[model samples]
Every structure is written in structure tokens, then in C-alpha cells.
Target: MSAEKKPAPKVEPLRKTRPCPECGKPSQREHYPFCSNRCRELDLSRWLSGSYAIPVAGDEAMADGEDEN
Candidate 1:
């Protein structure tokens, strides 16, 4: 039998930390870095209010593609 030894398994790094994107305070899991549900909701409201958007092709462009014209 050989005397070679296997190396230990590698461990994963801890989560990245940052101040709450909303309140600029330390983040926690329960409130998820926002401090509270109220803050979380406030952040969500901004997203829903067209403050954040993903671009999509206009209806006319899509129609032309379908017909290959």
C-alpha cells in the first residue's frame, strides 16, 4: 500500500456584505438588509412604478418578424 495522503476539502466563502441598498445600514436576513418590511415594500414600490424596466421590442417590430416581410 502507498503512503500518499489526500488533501482536505475546500470550504466555501461567507456571503458578501453591504449596507442596505435602501437605508444605508447593515443588512440582516429577516429584513434582508432593508431593516424592515416597510423598507422592503418601499423598494418594491420603486420597481413597480417604472423606476426599473427591462426593454422589449415594440408591437410593430414583433408583428413584422412574424410575417418575415
Candidate 2:
């Protein structure tokens, strides 16, 4: 019996990556859109520290008034 050697399987990227939020490096599969753990942690830190936030379109005073009604 002859032994056949198979070619290595190709690994396609799971997602199209943009630059890392903390660094300019391309993303890795493990860390994803960030290049490394440090970048990921930095992003988390920013979020936890309130450096990142979502903007709401309504006034808080109006929302509070509506809630009472």
C-alpha cells in the first residue's frame, strides 16, 4: 500500500478585519477585531471607565415626565 500525503487545508479568515481600536495592527482570530489581549483589555477598560458611550436621541427630562404619566 502506498502512503499518500495530503495538502494542508486552507484557513479562510472568519471576518474581514479593520485596524485594532488601540493599535493599528490587523486583527487576529483569537483576539478578533483587536490584535492582542492588551488591545482588547484596553478597549474594555475604556468602556468600563466610560470613555465609550452610546448617545440617546431623547431628552432625559421628557422621558422622566412620560414615565410619571
Candidate 3:
């Protein structure tokens, strides 16, 4: 009896190539949305340091506090 090995199946990417958020370079598979480790780290640092934040509207801010009236 002879044994044969099967070839691996080809995999497809879910999405098309996109620019890195940090430096506007083509994103890499290793670093995903970022092109390289440096870009990835820079984005991480921004997140960790509170540099990226969602702005709140005046109404939302007032709702969080008691009404002065």
C-alpha cells in the first residue's frame, strides 16, 4: 500500500488591503491595521495614554450632572 500527502488548502483574506492608521502605509498581515511593529506600538501608546478619546456633547455632559435649576 502507498500513502500520499494532501496539499494544504488555499486561504483567502476577508478584506482588501488598507492603509495603516499611524503612517498611512499599506497594512501588513503581521501587524494587521498597522504596517509594522513601530506603527502598532505608537497606536497602542496613544490608546494607553488617553490620547484617543470620544467627544461628548454638551447635553450628554449636562445629563451626567444634576440640573442647576
Best by lDDT: 3
Query: Model 1 — which ten-residue stretch has the worst lDDT?
Result: 10-19
Every model: Cα RMSD to truth? 6.3, 5.4, 4.2
lDDT of 3 by residue, 16-40 (tens): 6799998899998888888999999
lDDT, candidate 3, equals 0.88
TM-score of 1: 0.50
Q: Per-residue CA lDDT of candidate 1, range 14-61, in tens?
A: 555668888887766667657678789999999999888877667876
Output the better candidate (2/3) by TM-score.
Answer: 3
- lDDT for model 1, please: 0.76
Backbone clashes under 3 angstroms, per model? 1, 0, 0
Candidate 2 residue runs with Cα over 4 Å from true position: 1-13, 56-58, 67-69
lDDT of each model, Cα atoms only? 0.76, 0.86, 0.88
Give candidate 1 regions above 4 Å deviation.
Answer: 1-17, 56-69
Tally clashing residue pairs in candidate 1. 1
Give residue 31's error in model 2 in angstroms: 0.3
Highest-scoring model, TM-score: 3
How many Å off is the CA of 56 in candidate 3? 2.2
Each prediction's TM-score versus the true structure: 0.50, 0.63, 0.65
